[model samples]
Target: MTTRKDYTRPLDIKHGRVDMGHGAGGRAAAQLIEEVFVKAFDNPYLRQGNDGAALAIPAGHRLVMATDAHVVSPLFFPGGDVGCLSVHGTINDVAMCGARPLYLTASFILEEGFPLAELKRIVDSMAAAAREAGVPVVTGDTKVVEKGKGDGVFISTTGLGVVPQGVDVGGANARPGDVILLSGTIGDHGVAVLSKRESLEFETTIASDTAALHTLVAAMLEAAPGGVRVLRDPTRGGLATTLNEIARQSGVGMLLDEAAIPVLPQVDAACELLGLDPLYVANEGKLVAVCAPEATEVVLAAMRAHPRGAAAVRIGSVTEDPHHFVQMATRFGGRRVVDWLSGEQLPRIC
Candidate 1:
């Protein structure tokens, strides 16, 4: 290697495409990182260009980490693309445990021949999301594969946070008499992706609710201060599947008020036309909070104050039942079992 004479030109982001050399961990890879990811995600740790980031977390707090892989098709959706989802998903997972996300790392798998412009757009979006969330992408890796062997792009993000002392929230923490509160409407993310994937025409615009919730979670924690029993975001299987998972984990039963659940009229109609149940659809920006009945008002108020949780409402309550089942009341004056999602209703709808 030349110490001073050798030089590499900037990447042709304007009209270039990804290729096998970029993943070879060589000059091309270094140049790509310098021109794209590092420039977009400008930070001291990333600028160091080390193999990994070295973070010094504060003492007296337990660390929480979460990793998520995003392989949703249509790479770009109505309201969001895979970029924001990768950030929001990881941040939300850590926030569910009552942690404040502090940092993140990302990895990308790029298919050969993929347009560099699209990749730049995604990386720029991801950088913006990280900045908005007050977290930085400290380190990341990139790999390019053969053209036909991979899709456009796949992103895996790892988030790191610290849990404040005495703040414990998890799926198994739910108890009988705890009230369940839904942050907002359901099935928006799934339907938004579906609309683009299938080209289903809808009169109204339906956008994915994908967003980072760490700030909202911080506000909620400030209000409850440990009153919350279980906190979860209904992502893949929507509200029904997430509730069922929590029920089984806590070995408790739930009684959901169907009429209380919020759903956008257009999303409801879309589900009806597709023979899909909104309960099993997915949401990216919403959350399900289980808190003591006494703290419901406080937590709801905190959520409603946030722009994302504008539709916060009490949907149901935890109950004492040996069955560990999730049952729902119907608008037709009947009850139905909100069962576990048997199969994938919308795969790759992240």
Candidate 2:
């Protein structure tokens, strides 16, 4: 089905915007794919030009997969955008299961008049993130919706990874006396998105902590094989809600040290001005890892060794309680039970 006409011209990536014809499965579509997506995310598997990618899985390894859809408002933010967020979110999800992300697939839904320049920026961001994570976008799809019917753009990403043997980490594995560790500061991503969405200018700006956490997870596993009990990236509901979910699943209670948990000063000020609790705000780049007490130092050391988790520290411990509640010891030397967020704190945050 080679055609001379389809190759007559190249896409106008500089000034053109996506049109309905780009998604119509015609010559326009082919040209768009050839010029934009393929050019940005060129790899051997993607170059195969097949409907599905053929991946050679390693023997004696179990496959782990996760999918996430990103609909964040203000596509471009301080730290990242929908493109990198799409890749990082799903990669973190797979890594939370103690897997090493290997490949990714992304699908895009574009509005009629979405700028091609913005699309190129997003695509380039995604390609860079995937390459940095050592994962390739092997296959993908693109669709267009009418103006006013859809947001500027929406990205859905799916990732595949391989879980090593003798490594079992999940929400239901935490037990009493297990130590809890946090990867980095809390509420950076949520605060960054909020400031951008509301056009609020703080004295100091905050950036989203969106990042791929598989490498950090890999380091922790290397430090202590089978020592990590549960690993979760606190995203939507923040650290409190994530801990609650794990406690309920593991049928145990949690105790957190408020003084030990990290929070950026700018983020603290933003939350104070907005009357928001940092614990309930979202975080895209941080994770909650519960491990055995004996291996806590080793895991913490390993986490601190990675650039993504340089500020990682032990923040809490698990306890025996029939009620499976998450409690926090305040900096004021008082204890308060940390409950779930009443409702959505920040909406449209990835």
Candidate 3:
């Protein structure tokens, strides 16, 4: 067992700054882990330390893995921060495949002058999120770069999960005649972050829908276990880009009802003010699911039953077309192409 020599020495978590030595794979690095990473995410797999984790997985289930990097501008945001977002983002990615997210590994790149109090807050939030999601941050790495060379802080997380028997879901599985469903309202996460940055005042403040979706996925699986063909969380490019990706991947076209798509009144107002389309705006806690037409009601019910997907609705359907175009029936009873976003609408808003 390794023990701190001077456990009595207080950690400079108030005003201390990081230095290159922190990433030099020496005493500074060990100290950082001992005082921060390990302390926040204490688990058995990390204690082993053999370059990567070794685990015993159950039989008859396929393993699923996903990785994502977090670099949102404000380390803290209206509803969530880099910490919880990192965990939720990766977990959602894994859950998108109808898998049960079980473990995670986090890597941090911290700038030299970043505040230790802020770091502690972020880590504590991350631990809480992981605990609430029932997934453990089992292993992690920390590296500190010199001031000005890096952002205040960036986090990269890798998630591992298991896909139960008879569960098959992916972008390539979307097929014609399948119904498309959204977990909840769109553009909340992007609008919330933007409001915080621009200091915009609103009658009803928008909050980022940053949350883990595995439980919702589990509920969906229980409702229509094998009927779900594809599941994706519309994040960076929002629903439009994500749907287009699925269309291209599955070689199918999509038709959406503009009136059927759910959007919060505040989000719509915010997008109008910013000259942005809510469809192109990012979302952190919503999922777009493609399921058999017969299973649409079942899936929608499951999604609505989950707190994260309380506003769930059936928004569209897949069609047989080689062009793989996504069209929307406008509110005025007209149809228009919902093409891919031309340029970045709101970068770093995720």
Q: Compose the digit string of candidate 3's lDDT tens values, residues 62-165.
A: 99999999998777888999999999999999999889999999999999878878888899899899989989998888888879889888999999999988
The TM-score measured for candidate 2 stands at 0.96
Runs of candidate 1 exceeding 4 Å displacement:
1-7
Tens-digit per-residue lDDT, 1-350, candidate 2: 33233334777789888888777778788888888899999999889998888988889899998999999988999999998999899999999999999999999999988999999999999999999889999999999888888898899999999998889999999999999999999999999999999999999889999999999999999999889999999999899999999999999999999999999999999999999999999998899999999999999999999998999989999999899999999999999999998789988898
Candidates ranked, most accurate by TM-score first: 1, 2, 3
Tell me the number of clashing residue pairs for each predicted model: 0, 0, 0
User: After superposing candidate 3, which stretches have Cα over 4 Å from the reference?
Assistant: 1-8
Please give the lDDT score at residue 92 for candidate 2. 98
* Model 3 weakest lDDT span, ten residues long: 1-10
lDDT of 1 by residue, 302-336 (tens): 99999988889999999998999899999998988
Worst 10 residues of 2 by lDDT: 1-10
Clashing residue pairs, backbone N/CA/C < 3 A, model 2: none
Give each model a TM-score.
0.97, 0.96, 0.95
lDDT of 2: 0.92
Q: What is the alpha-carbon lDDT of model 1 when measured against the actual structure?
A: 0.92
